[model samples]
Target: MGTRGQSSAMGREARDPRLDAVIQTLQEIGNLMGRQAQERAANIAQATEAATTAAVNGNQANQGQAQLKPPKFDGKGDPEAAPRWVEELEKAFEVLGCTEAEKVTLAVYLLQDNANDWWKATRGRVFPEGTAQTWAVFSENFYGKFFSESAKERKLAEFMRLHQGQMTVDQYEAEFARLSKFAPRMIDHPEDKA
Candidate 1:
């Protein structure tokens, strides 16, 4: 009876080693899967942080550029409108931080009534479209047609005669800057410009 019992116990010990190996393998697999899941979660978190930082930086840069309100156009370009429109439009561009190309296109759209028709039919060329060419052509056309040589001469004379008057230093400087465009030739030296 003792020999039979001993043999049965040895058989049971042999089966237990195989069951222990299987349990150990399952635990190792579970630990590997847990580590992979943790790594994936960390990656997702890092990506989300980077995206948020980029969006915030973009908003800040845009704010630094231009947060100005949109402008309404009264139309009626060139000649009669040249004086006021030049000042007003340039100011609007500064406020809005528009590109030179945008200034040209916006100038066209701003024209009202007869001006738009005249420009589209006769003055505005279509062959050289896009930013650089359009800006150059439009500037040449606008200054030549709208602002006549005689008118520019008169503005130059006015610029020569201009003084500070009763205005503040800031106001005087602004007026000088505005008038300077008419007599660009006078500004030959850096000291003269200053």
Candidate 2:
């Protein structure tokens, strides 16, 4: 009876030791797998962040390149239809790399048929003939012929009479600032400006 009990006890001890060793080996493998998964996740996150940053940097570089090389103008304008012809023309001149001396001739070339008529009629009347002038002179001459003093005065009066109707305070302030450029002499005091 003692021999039989001892053999049963020994068998139970052997099974317990083997089971414990198997459990410990499995736990170690699980821990190692968890660490590897964490490392993989971190590496994937880092790669995603780097790719996003690279895309943004590439966009910025493209924008910088675009600014360096200005777009070409097709020289299309109408004084009555597009009232801001002078502004458009000036932008085009800057893009086309036109010098101050070449501006007048380029302006003449780009003028629509009707605008050319006005230019011819008002060239000497507004500005002297054959003047070696900047784009500013040409702009003043062209705009002066079309935009009369009466119109400027009307615009200035409208700007002065502006109200913050149906607009937020920020919107009203922006509108006021925009209109103020039209009538620089009207608002002398900063208090009145506000």
Off by over 4 Å in 2: 1-83, 92-97, 123-130, 187-194
lDDT of 1 at 6: 98
- Candidate 2's TM-score reads 0.46
1-194 per-residue lDDT for model 1 (tens digits): 99999999999877878788999999999999899777755764554455456556777645433323223334444343565565666765665445666677667777766657757775435424442645556656766666788888888888889999899999999988888877787876546643
Which candidate's lDDT is highest? Answer: 1
Alpha carbon lDDT of each predicted model: 0.66, 0.64
- Per-residue CA lDDT of model 2 for 1-194, tens digit only, reads 99999999999877877788899999999999899777755764554455456556777645533332222233233223223455555664555455676567666776666666766677776557676667777767665666667667766777978999999999999888866766776677656545
Best by TM-score: 2
What's the TM-score of each model vs. the native?
Answer: 0.44, 0.46
Enumerate residue pairs that collide in model 1.
76-112
